[model samples]
Target: MTSTDSTRSRWIRLLILAVVAVALAHALDGVAWRSARLLSVNDKDWGRLLRSMGYLPTWGVIALGFWLQQRDHPQRSRYAWALLLGPALSGGVAEVLKLLIRRLRPNPDVFEYAFRPFADGPLSNRGMGMPSSHTLVAFAGAAVLAQLYPRARWLWYTLAAGCAATRVLAMGHFLSDTVVAAVLGVAVSTLYWLRWVEPLPAP
Candidate 1:
């Protein structure tokens, strides 16, 4: 296929995935929320820990550590740059969407479609659900790192998945929130990697 055709095809696939994700979110919100509630009753602590893995400080430290360790390596700069920038961009985008969309967190009192955009002002912390930021950050980091370190792609993606699961397990977001965020995170990081980091040398 021509480059233009390939790009169009990719966009079409993404559009289809978005449609499917929305449908799944609507159909499975109750089931997903209930399952999470059940599993998290006994595993809330574990879920919190996994969620922390995606926090800025947590992954920032990891990326910085890799950079420090690979100072003499050929792709150290690229790894460092991609790891830091990818997650930052992903999380930033998620945060903005959370504010703009302002979907309510999954709760017994609220259904999956609840929204309260700017209800408490732009800086409002309430109802800032949908597109779990934790998942986005985790997956963005995973996508970039996996690309840079292909051998450990499974490990990276597994950790990212754990991060995504934690959002549901904690009742912090609906299933759709994490699913969409996972896709967005990977898309953002992959695009960034392809446009900028892919040309860099790798060890």
Candidate 2:
């Protein structure tokens, strides 16, 4: 297939995998709940580790990496916007969904806390759950890094997975919430990388 055809095919397959994942998350609710409970272990050390992944630090690293990577190329600035906007786009979308859905998070103190969907929860809680922004940021970075450093693709994803796990284990989000965020993170970042940031890797 031509490059265009190949890219389109990859997009379709990736989306299919995302959809399948979301469906499975719902279909296997019991397993997801159990897994979430098991993973929800509060640890100050773990929280500190995940803090490096918070919005500011995460994007800070992206900016620093972009700066360092572009130091050699003449058109390095050309990629600056894409690098900064990757997380913005991903978090922006996730934020909107969280508000629109108004899904209350699993109690950060109680893994077994009942999920409150669209209960118009506290204003402070609005846009706080459903799809996880942290996971989105992690996967967004992974998606871009996977394209930029193909050799370390798995490493990036592994980091993203670990980061996502912390979000759950720290009792910050539900399993389904992170799963949805992961899918969106991959989809949005891949789309950005392919259309504006970089060409898709050959299959």
lDDT of 2 by residue, 1-203 (tens): 89999988987897788889887865654454556553434356665565455364666667677778776764554355555677678988888887776666776444453544554463344536778888888788777777777899999888787777777665577777888998988888777876875642322
TM-score for candidate 1, please give it: 0.85
Query: Which 10 successive residues of model 2 have the least lDDT summed?
Result: 108-117
The TM-score between candidate 2 and the true structure equals: 0.79
1-98, model 1: which lDDT tens digit per residue? 99999999988998898789778876888888776664453266666667775797777787788888888875557778788889999999998888
Top candidate, metric TM-score: 1
For model 2, the stretches where C-alpha displacement exceeds 4 angstroms are 38-47, 107-127, 199-203
* Whole-model lDDT per candidate: 0.81, 0.70
